[model samples]
Target: MTTYIPQLTLPEQVFASAPASILLPVALGTTVGYSTRPKQTKETYNLIRQPPLRPPPWVFGPVWTVLYGLTGYGAYRGIGLNLTSILPGTMSVARRAATLYTVQLGLNLAWMPLFFGARRPAAAMLDVLALLGANAYLACLFFGTRDGLADPVAGWCWAPYLAWLSFAAYLNAGVGYLNGWDISDATLRRRKAVGKGAQ
Candidate 1:
């Protein structure tokens, strides 16, 4: 008697063979790469932030990890479908959306390096804008792809991404203003409060 190993169909095979963990680093690489600019940037950031907003630093890791998994899977679904007979306009839009999505992720990856590595909040703000723009376009293009069966899942996937980009935009802008304006006085107050256990 021999043990049998079942063969996965093509897409399943791709899904099954691909490790889900790969999404983690790619998602986190965005963070790590962005954070490498200079440690001092984070210092002033901490001083200015003082109390800190945006869901306490500890929460981001788990949240982004889960989000990246969803994002990668959604990407696979949105682009992996056969488009042999789809209209040219839709195809063009879809391709454009896919390109946008790729750019957004690439930008996402680059953002950390710019913000944290180089300590360039202004540059990070620029990158976040691109990410938001690309995601917005992808949402619309994918909207056209929506049908009775696929619309719910595909449309739903982009919602979180849009929300996330929006929040990131705010964060980037806020950081840039605080840093670029050189509000050393305001930062001192917050920094002092932290020392007093005000947070």
Candidate 2:
């Protein structure tokens, strides 16, 4: 006797298979960061001494747009892999990897507000460092070898992000150093007021 299996509808299959749930929120958060671009550009220009390797201000938007797309796609692919896995152990590992991805994404989202909105390079440097750490951890999770469940595509997808963050850490440190970033809130407010007056 043959056992009958229920077939999934197209929408159900797509809903179950696709990673939109994970990617959409990430894309939304990234979009929100664009609102801070003008402030970031102004602050960057006003820097007394930018790092030697700093890219043109215009480069950031395009670069991050590409990077965020890659990141979201990588995450979507990773989650797809997880969702289709058969074993409970595999599912657990995938869930852990997804969680790490979320943590790093949160760090990514926090950096803009700290750096541009608050104009606190020192604090932002700390956030960037933490972001670097999270990226590293997530990369390791994606490339884990001992279990033979490594997702090389997902792991390699983080390469550009990790490289960018390394450069950003250097730039953040340079900005913090050159600007003496330990100033008070009042000083920051006064500087912003003065900057607005000049513009």
Candidate 3:
């Protein structure tokens, strides 16, 4: 009997092998995204009419920290599988998945700014919808059953993120409905005016 291990491509050897390196950028990206919001945004967020199901504000930080870590690990695993696969066409599928993942991350980062910093829940909801779509596509790619790659572990890894996004979509929709602002460019301006008047 003979055992064979697929050789890692140069890129994989340099990048995919170290999960920590992949996770480092994810953590930093999330930190930068969070920092984009003004300090006043937190005060505004706390004052908003959140849905009854909304978790306390403190919950978000811990949840997101765990989610970011899991997502980074999942990405690392998916990329490693693709890079080291002996199977033809695996890398292409993985590349597509990675791209979608990147796009969703961007969308994720954009939501906080749109909702809290810019005070535009409507715009944030749009970003959330796009994020949901990208996340679903990425999850399917990892599951690979339909696509024939079959990496259940990687697929499961994305479960938390998907769940969180779904909850967030509900929250975003609730906020938009409660605030009476959706797709209206004037909403932010109106909010600013009201904030100024109150001050």
Candidate 4:
């Protein structure tokens, strides 16, 4: 049997293409997008109406920073390794895991649009519930694959997202209660006040 030898030289993209690295940029860009949806200046209330127990806006930065880094890498490694191992058409555990990952990512991206873009808290809640289901699906797929490395890592990556959305869901529900379906009129007044205050 020949001993496998390690090559000191590998493709640059191996490191460059790392999933973890992708997370920082996507997250940073997403951050910008997320922030832009808020008031024009000064500040409005926290993104949602909640008791003071709610986390500060600053907390989200640190929390998502860690979570996104882990998420991008875990997802990248899981799908990357598995996809490279087999044909796309193969019915294997890796393929299954990869598919679930894609679904979850799609749901994750949808939250911003449904909430901020459309300002539909009710619709956003529904989307988040679906997001929850997708995360559960991904977790189960990861655990069942028995791949050792991917399962727990993948599951762990999803936990914070689950927690954040859970909080957001509650906040959305409460705000919808305190406000109403169309907060546009109220929100516009608030934004104008905030923008004026900044000046």
Candidate 5:
């Protein structure tokens, strides 16, 4: 494929900048994590039937912080690159790759609410499944496969994220199966009320 060197636009300049790019996802992730009720998240995590090898609750914050940083860096790298030459009206490969990246980021932000805030394991599992699929495609796009743009550095940034998602999938499935896919606060309250009534 021919290399197409195009003028850098304002959007690209902003996203390609290190500080802005790196801070975007990190900030969003942190906000989502905190807004979703951190205390209840930890408490629910403790009460749930977790899979073997699940890390402690404290581990999540740091791990996600690092992952979001990498994600932003990857976006910076990918956005700054000259797009591979392609026909008009079909959308450039770079744009497609960028779009996929954004989609995966949204999926990433959505998981915490699904799993912790709403306490819907089944929905959370589905969201994770979608996140995994979308990210896999995104990784392919960034890595310069026939179906992807040519940016090895961006691809590498997403690799660790993929690995983490694999582990998360296992944990999500395990928790869903072990806990019968029901972990809502209402259910817990109902169970408590039933016990008191029986007494």
Candidate 6:
């Protein structure tokens, strides 16, 4: 089977670099986490019905930081370097891997906004489900290429992330179910206000 190789643009080249690749995701994840307001997110988490085995809100930051770093390092090792000279016939695989990496990164970034910012647990659950699938495929792509490129380190980096996503999916689903699928802060406030007025 033939796989199409994509040409990397200059910005892509910068992003795929050793430092930038790793820093970008970590930075972006941190930015999104903060932009959504950590205090508010923590409050929301406390307000909602969490699933059994849900970790404290504090755990998410450090865990995600580590995962993001691992993801970045994996990209740097698996997709950024020019394998043409070292491993002939691996560029196509690397390019495809890079494309997948970018795609999965976007999927990863969308979940926080969906869950916290928009206050949509159902949508966030769906987003994480897609993210899980995409990362699974990406991990496979990183682990072994059709043309005999094998980078176990990169693939292994995704292992923890995949496991976490599984747990996250459970948490997402559990929260949605426990809350009767409605956890909107605005709705909750409106109902309270209506109750006061009626009384």
In candidate 5, position 168 carries an lDDT of: 96
Decreasing TM-score order of the candidates: 6, 5, 3, 2, 4, 1
Most lDDT-accurate candidate: 6
Models 1 onward score TM values of 0.66, 0.76, 0.79, 0.67, 0.83, 0.85
Positional deviation of 157 in candidate 1, in angstroms?
0.9
Which 10-residue span in candidate 1 carries the lowest summed lDDT?
1-10
Clashing pairs in 6: none
Better of 1 and 5 by lDDT: 5
If candidate 4 were superposed on the true structure by all CA atoms, what would the RMSD be? 8.9
Candidate RMSDs in order = 10.2, 8.2, 6.8, 8.9, 5.3, 4.0
Q: Can you write out model 1's per-residue Cα lDDT over 150-198, one digit (the tens) per residue?
A: 3345556778978987887887787666555333445446656666334
Best by TM-score: 6
Give the alpha carbon lDDT tens digit for every residue of 1-199 in model 6. Answer: 2243344222456445778888888999999999999998887877776779999999999999999999888877777763443655777667666666776788889999998889898999889998898788878877775653477888898899999999999999998898777779865566456752221
- Cα lDDT of model 4 by residue, 90-184, tens digit: 22555555545555556666766666666677887787788777666666555454432245666676677677777867776775676554445
Off by over 4 Å in 4: 1-17, 20-44, 86-91, 145-150, 187-199
Candidate number with the higher TM-score (2 or 6): 6
Q: Weakest 10 consecutive residues, lDDT, candidate 3?
A: 1-10
How much lDDT does each candidate structure score?
Answer: 0.55, 0.65, 0.68, 0.56, 0.76, 0.78
Q: Give the per-residue Cα lDDT of candidate 3 at 60.
A: 80
For residues 94-129, write the lDDT of model 3, one tens digit per residue.
655655565567788788878776778888889999
Q: Residue 32 of model 1: what lDDT? A: 72
Better model by lDDT, 1 or 6? Answer: 6
What local lDDT score does residue 170 receive in model 6, on the 0 to 100 scale? 97
TM-score of 2: 0.76
Worst 10 residues of 4 by lDDT: 1-10
